[model samples]
Target: MEGILNILKPPGMTSHDVVDFIRKIYNTRKVGHTGTLDPDAAGVLPVCVGGATKFVSYLVEQDKRYRFEITFGFSTDTLDKSGKIIKSGPVRFLKEKELRQVLREFEGKIKQIPPIYSAKKIKGKKLYEYAREGKIIDIPPIEVTIYNIDLVEYESPYQVLIDVKCSKGTYVRALVRDICEKLNMPGYMSMLIRTEVGAFRIEDAYTLEEIKEKKPSLQPIDKFIKLPSVHLNKIEAEKILKGQFISNRHSIETSFLKLYDNNGKFLGIGVSERNKIRPKRLL
Candidate 1:
């Protein structure tokens, strides 16, 4: 009951809605989701329970992978199919080579403007709040890295499917808008599915029905945390539990280490500085 659950989120349910459902299923209020996924999109969403909640911020920083479809011929106010159509035009087929070249321009680091109908904040207000009130605001662009973009399929003149690997804070809807603008065509996202986040993959995700029938097998906290490890004797483990610093004789080349006891029990996390290791968090 105190580890991570890789849940396959269903479309039309907000990320918080899934967390609430899990809370009720587990009958505990200690469950939380690592990040937010638009209600219209679906896929793998990792939920942390009990002590794992302390590491949720770490999981949020990891890279994410997504598969999405874009339909040409029009743009929407929300940059997705669920929005009002703002512009429309006839679709024109582009050569695969030309399309690939345009995608390349988005790879690596680039500046992107998020859609107005988004969760981004401005002046202590969500951007979508302003959009909902029929107000226009200048949205500033932010830098994000697109590690890779692969063309999965292209339907002549109208639809294109692609897989993208990107850093945190990337907006797939914004990406689709930019891609369409690059081609001098109007388009909007028709579908989106997050395939992966850090070490969590859709292949390992469990549906809500499956989770209800069979209790979820939680993943150990240490497995997903990519840090060097330090195994301690009972004496050292007790000291860490009391929030004490210990001498670091081993030259571990990392800022942080996953702490464990002699019997292979995960103790928690530790930070290293100047040959000294101090307890950062304890289970």
Candidate 2:
């Protein structure tokens, strides 16, 4: 009831759809998704339950890996298969080396424009909502880092599979669009599979059917949150829990830390500032 779930979300189900399923299975209202995954794509999505929901903010910042296919025939409104085709062109296959060279330009830091039909919010209103209402808005490009990108597989003149490792908030749909532009051809994201999210891998993720039929173990919150820990005595722990700051010249130079009790039990998270530590979040 109070742990994290690494779910293998299926295509066609939005991130919130998976959260709703988990809410019923666990019978808890305090369920949340770490980040939004596109409904047309499938892959590893982390879900937090009960007290673990407090750590959702941290999980959303983790890097991610994905495998996707780009079809070089036409482009769409959504930049994916889910959208209407806006333009069509003859398929021209690029030499493997040519494509690889183009991909290198995207490695490292680059500005990327998110798809309009996405869950990105503007003033608490989702971008897709505006798009559906036939409202025109200038979508801004964001800076995202692509740690590495490689040609996974090439399938003739129509489709090619690619693997990418990127920082948080990188949109694979936009990556495909950019790659096509560099080729001077039209393309759309044909398929997408998120292979990993931080330390969570697709192979280790559970599907909804598996969860409904089997009694699987829920992973501890500490399993994913990698931070230095500080142990406190009962007296100090009580004070920290009561929103009182403890002054100490701690050797660990971190802005945040995982707090633990004398018995080695996780006490939530603490923020360190000006040589004083205060509870940032508690279970």
Candidate 3:
């Protein structure tokens, strides 16, 4: 049960709900999801089980790829179709050339203010909790990298489909809102599907029913973590397990390295900063 399960979260269930479902099936308390997907969003959601739960931070930080639809003419409280309409205005749909030009402007690093109805925490409570109470709070913008954002297709006059590849913590709904403002038109996200998250792809994801019926036949934790593997002898492996810093003759400059025993047992993740391997966690 100590591995990663790429769950195809249906639109109706929250990320927590999927985690709970896994927990009940496995009857383990250590199960957790790498990131949260809004209830209205259906796509790849990596679930960590057993010792894999300790590496949630690493998975959460990985970049994501999504295919989302941005619908023009109105804005919502949640910035998505799931929320109530907060404002409406004349619809001004942009042509493919104009939309492509506008999308190019977000190809690099940019600052983005998260939507008010989000899971981001203020103090100890989620920001969405405040929004539910009809409270307005200023959430500052943070630097996020949008590696690629291209106009995929336009299904209708008001709906523009886009494919986005961005770093972690990026809100596609908020991105739609920003792009709408750039076009001098208000909009909200109509549909969203996360295609990838790091090495996890949507194609490998399983529906809740499929998982419950098949049980856990998921990939190992190491599959979810993309790192260079370094084989270690018994002596080095013991040292690594004890959380001792080990120096190797061969120097490879990488932020982290995968430590494995002679038997090729996936030990855990380790940092190789300053030519010293300091073990971070033990699997």
Candidate 4:
């Protein structure tokens, strides 16, 4: 109950809904999800429980991989099929060469504007709230890195399937919108499935039914987080637990390190700065 659960969130249930379900299952209020996945989308959602909740931010910042379908001939207010159609046109087929070229343009760092009907916040309010109230707000474009995009399949003049590996905050729906604009056609995300998030993959995810029957095998925090680690002696471990800064002889290059004791017990996380390691979060 104090570790992470790789839950396969089915479509139609919001991320918060999954968190609430896990809270009820474990009967603990300390459960939380790493990030939000669209209700209309299904895939891997990592839920943290008890002490694991303290490391949720680390999981949120990890890279994600997704497989999605972009349907041509229409654009929606939400940039996905769940929203009302805002525009439509006759579907036009693009050659595989042309599609590949267009996808290449999206690779690397690019500026992207998130869809209006999204969870993004503006002026202390979620952007979707303003959209629902019939208000128009200038949404600024953010720089996001698309690590790689591969064309998985193209079905005639209607749908193009793609696999995308991108940095955090990269919205696949927005990428579809931009690709359609470049192709001079209307399009919207028809289907989306997040295959991976950070080190968590869909293959290891558990369905709700499976979770109800058997308790999820919780992963150790040190194993889930990708960070350098430092093993300390009993004296050093005691110092860390007391919130004292210890000498950093390990010379870890990262800003943070997974801390462990002499007997190999996980000791939460430690912050490394200059040549000192200080307690960041102690379990």
Note the Cα lDDT for every prediction shown.
0.92, 0.90, 0.87, 0.92
User: Which TM-score value belongs to model 2?
Assistant: 0.96
In model 2, which regions exceed 4 Å deviation?
none
Per-residue alpha-carbon lDDT of model 3 for 113-194, expressed as tens digits? 9888888887787889988898888787988999999888986578888999999989888899889989988899999999
Which stretches of candidate 3 lie above 4 Å from their native place? 123-125, 273-276
TM-score per candidate, chains pooled: 0.95, 0.96, 0.92, 0.96
lDDT of residue 229 for candidate 3: 83
Query: What digit string (tens of lDDT, one per residue) describes model 2 on residues 99-206?
Result: 899999999999998888888887778889999999988888899999999998888889899999999999899899999999989999999999999999999999
- Order the numbered candidates by lDDT, best leading: 4, 1, 2, 3
- Residue pairs clashing in model 3 are none
| Number of backbone-clashing residue pairs for each candidate, in the order shown | 0, 0, 0, 0
Measure candidate 1: CA RMSD.
1.4
User: What is the Cα-based lDDT of residue 247 in candidate 4?
Assistant: 91
Question: lDDT tens string, model 1, 226-279?
Answer: 888899888888889999998786688688899998899998899988888899
